[model samples]
Target: MQDSNLFDDSQLIFRVLVNDRLEYSLWPTVAGLPAGWAESFGPASYEACASWLERHWQHLRPSGLLAKGGGRG
Candidate 1:
C-alpha cells in the first residue's frame, strides 16, 4: 500500500504485526510533509531495510517470478 502525493501533510507508520509472535512496528518519522500526508512506507534507510529483507527473503518471494523448481531463471 503506497501513498501518492506526499506534499499533503501526513504521518506514516508502517508496521509488522505477527499475531502468534509479537508485534513489531517500524515507523521512522520523516519530515517535509504537512501533518497528515506521506509517501509510501519508505525508501527505507539502507542497513536496517537490508537486514529485514535478508531475514524475510524466502517468505517474501514472488512465486510467479520463479521458475519450475523455484529458481529465478
Candidate 2:
C-alpha cells in the first residue's frame, strides 16, 4: 500500500494570528488588488509593500490551489 500526503512538504509556514476565538490569516496586499482582497494601502506605499513581500517570500506559503502530495515525484 502507498501512503498519501495531502499537502505540500514545503518548508514555508503561513503566518496566522489567533486572537480570542477568531483566526486571522496575514497576507501581503497590493495598493490596488484585482478582486476579493482587502486594501491595505493606508501607510505603506507600493514599493515598500513589494520590498516587504520579497524579504519574507521564503516564509510565505503558496496558495493551496494545487494538489501537492503523493509519492516522490
Candidate 3:
C-alpha cells in the first residue's frame, strides 16, 4: 500500500547508491534504481540518509578516479 504521507517532505523516503566510480547518490525509492548501480543503505527518511552521507562520503571523487589522477584539487 502506498501512503501519501510518505511522499511528504517530513517523511520522504530515499535510498543510497554508489556507482563504479564510487560516487554517492540519493535516489528516490519510488523511482527505483538505475543500471550499473547498487543500493548501499536505504528506505530511510531523507534527513537520515543525508546524515549517513555526511558520515561516509567524505571525498567527492571516487577512489579509482583519484588514483587515476582525477582529483578536484
Candidate 4:
C-alpha cells in the first residue's frame, strides 16, 4: 500500500475554512475541521478552492483590524 499526502492528492476533496479573523484556509474534508474555523466553501477540487480564495480573499488583513480602520492609507 502507498501512503498518500492529503494536501497534494488531487483525488481527495477539500473545503475552504474561515476563522473569526476572516482568514481563509484550505482543509481536507477527510480530516476534522479545526477550532474557531467554519466552512466557507464546499467540498471541491483544490484548484476550485484556490480560485475561490483568489476571488474572495483579496485583502489579507483580518476583519477586526479592518473594522478598526487599520490597513488603510
Best by TM-score: 4
lDDT of 3 by residue, 2-73 (tens): 556433554568988888888888877887689989998887888888889999888887789788887695
Which has the higher lDDT value, candidate number 3 or candidate number 4? 4
**lDDT, residue 1, model 2:** 100
lDDT of each: 0.39, 0.33, 0.80, 0.89
User: Model 1 compared with the native: what TM-score?
Assistant: 0.27
Clashing residue pair totals per candidate (backbone < 3 A): 6, 0, 0, 0
Judged by lDDT against the true structure, how good is candidate 1? 0.39
Residue-wise C-alpha lDDT for candidate 1, range 2-53, written one tens digit per residue: 7764323234423222222222333434533334333333445534544564
Q: What's the distance in Å from true for residue 65, model 4?
A: 1.0
Candidate 2 lDDT (Cα, 0 to 1): 0.33
Please give the range of 10 consecutive residues that has the lowest summed lDDT in model 2. 14-23
Error of 3 at 72 (Å): 2.8
**Model 2 error, position 37 (Å):** 0.9
Between candidates 2 and 3, the lDDT winner:
3
Worst 10 residues of 4 by lDDT: 4-13
Q: Candidate 2 on 1-73: residue-level lDDT in tens?
A: 9774322222222222222212223332322232344433223433454454455444333333223533231
In model 2, what lDDT does residue 2 have?
78
Predicted candidate 4 versus true structure: per-residue lDDT over 1-73, tens digit per residue: 9998787776678999999999999898998999999999978988898899999997988998899988863
Q: State the RMSD for candidate 1.
A: 10.9
Candidate 1 wrongly placed segments (more than 4 Å) = 1-44, 59-61, 65-73
